[model samples]
Target: MAPAAITLAAEAPKLSAANTGFMLICSALVMLMTPGLAFFYGGMVRVKSTLNMLMMSFISLGIVTILWVLYGFSLAFGTDKGSLIGWDGDFVGLSGIGLTQLWDGYTIPVYVFAVFQLMFAIITPALISGALADRVKFTAWALFITLWATIVYFPVAHWVWGTGGWAFDLGVIDFAGGTAVHINAGAAALGVILVIGKRAGFKKDPMRPHSLPWTMLGAGLLWFGWFGFNAGSWLGNNDGVGALMFVNTQVATAAAMLAWLVYEKLRHGAFTSLGAASGAVAGLVAITPSGGAISPLGAIAVGAIAGVLCAMAVGLKYKFGYDDSLDVVGVHLVGGIAGSLLIGFFATGGGQSDAAGLFYGGGLSQFWKQCAGVGGVLAYSLVVSAILAFLIDKTMGMRVSEDDEVAGIDQVEHAETAYDFSGAGGGTAARAPQPAPSATTAPNTKKVDA
Candidate 1:
């Protein structure tokens, strides 16, 4: 083992109050991302399916949190077993893990690291909900996330982030989670959507977003929360690299938003709010892995490319005959791949890692390594996610009945409606009128003067 790795393993765990506090705050920020995602997805779905969309994202918070504490963390971050996955039940339920012991090289306590990672685990599976929106059974969706997190996310996270994990050892530069979170979730979205099939009126019906304002709000929240997602991956380094990551995140997102707007105006003849929000998200995704390694200029380039490409990519569902309800395949999957692969050309070697990119005179070695990492995660996630979706579909049922789907999932599944139009003579509202206006008392009192 290298000296740094040896030191990481051998050092006694100690606390850094600064790092601990920073990580705690970062965890909270990351936690907000799930709800942010909920709004982002919720707003894009039809009014009838809005709550269900929100629920899908929210449920992951509950399921993954419990699972992570129980064994998800252990499977992802536990002692390495053959570089495939982590092992050891000791970390399950956080058992036998000392409170004072810091993670290998970090100054924060192990518990803090676990919780920080827990936030990532929660959101990754939730990212898939958008593609499967409007048609899935809520119970089945919950079960799918639980199983998917266990089988797919846990092991993949281990591969990308865990010590002695294959990609980690192979030098893949995923600063935050381009491969582990975005690409992984995006690929899984494609797989599940393939199995579940398209929405009922996917092409013929005009399934425009019920509320773009809501989506804009959600996108704003996501942009605010992503700072923690990307910069906090530094884990309280409080150094120049973290600052650089922060700046790059902001710059890349703005550039992507602009790029998306430009593309939209050119292609569709209008600058839509949806385009702006989606473009911002694309920038955020593109910069996630490369932000810490690349310069601000590189960040802009990455964001612009992702913005244009993803905007173009979203239309692929129509061409390819797939119904990616919210374009998860386009924005996340494509954006993630762009970010991870671009690191090969833009990396400055000045950040946390000393690996330089081809443009920086490092050659194509890093680029090929990046391709390997992206391809491996994409392939694994797609295959496993498809099998999981298929098994769930075969055994219990994945999609709701056609009746339930068209009648609105909120009413059919949750027995509640997102918008109540009863007062205005709309949608299932009671038509009870005022009790005849107190017939004897008030009718003529004010008319006496007339």
Candidate 2:
């Protein structure tokens, strides 16, 4: 090749509109998962706190977007600092990069890459809201996620995905975010819940989902959006890896849902809607880190293992005396751990990298790498998150007043309610008066619908 031609090639990768368009769609899909999460969690809480639950997740979209644009991206993807963090002055406020400049050698524009990652940051902390439901003060919860994101999430994202990051350097395989997104949020959830304590009634109240249909719908959205979440991490489908990730995602999720239902049926004697929903999420979480690295058959194993493990782990709070309002710890934490570790056992050399898992004759090298990645993210997120929560709890007060909590957080915090129990007229206004029935007392009881 001519020197000028080589110089031009070395200057930048050829931009591809196809890849950029695909990424834009994926970013939108991932963005949709936040509201999907809101609905899923909203339906799980009592009617009294339904809107509050939804708000907890919805608020992240606003909080994290501002943060990401300001400095979160710089800290996460900038030039590496000791493999622990990143810092690029130009990346701060995203002012230095050109709109058309590509991300690392990827075909998509830098703006597209930043926005895609912003979606991940937004949803990661939102995942913590489920474990703190019904008891936390909304403002306190907001502040905590803010501080937690600044202190914990940014550094961790750098470590997991940034160039020269320790995990990236160590050859730890995280195709999507088994550790960065799921385990990070799960551990943080456990930390905060420990400080805030349980819901007001705890074991006495029969707190059940207000609407399983909403939960199912939310789960469906998450599943749909997750195609983008898992596949887009590869950034494109050019070499077919992203397509492989997409297929694996579906296969594993289906397998995990079945595994969870089987566990539920054998253990509880009935297949519940809740079981199906939870199972599906467990599969998604498990496959997220490994999907790009494993075959579809391996994905089934990862999903089934995560489903049963998370199902069994869900009851630990009752036995161990902690209250995780919606099993975030069980599903995200356990499933994340299972999926991360399984990458050591299931990864094939042909998928994402030449490093095979134990089953593929790759030995324990990758397994130990997986262990390190999982442990590092879990420990850091847990400790820093707990400190942030405790500080918030001590200074500003974290939980709502017991009276307000029992009365419903939605009304106390947001001045609204999810449902109205008043007689048919839906507004907050008082009911109109009714006239008395006269001597025609044999009256209106014609087989009416109650």
Off by over 4 Å in 2: 1-12, 423-450
Q: Count of backbone clashes for each model? A: 1, 0
lDDT per residue as tens, model 1, 220-315: 989988988888899886477888999999999999999999999999999999999999999999999899999999999999999999999999
lDDT (10s digit) by residue, model 2, range 1-450: 999999987877767899999999999999999999998898888888899999999999999999999999999999999999999998899999997898988889999999999999999999999999898988998898788889999999999999989999998888889999999999999998888888887987678898999999999999999999999999987899999999999999999999999999999999999999999999999999999899999999999999999999999999998899999999999999999999999999999899999999999999999999999999999888888999998999999999999888999999998877765554445455657778786475532211
Instruction: Please give the TM-score that candidate 2 achieves against the real structure.
Output: 0.93
What lDDT score belongs to each candidate, Candidate 1 first?
0.92, 0.92
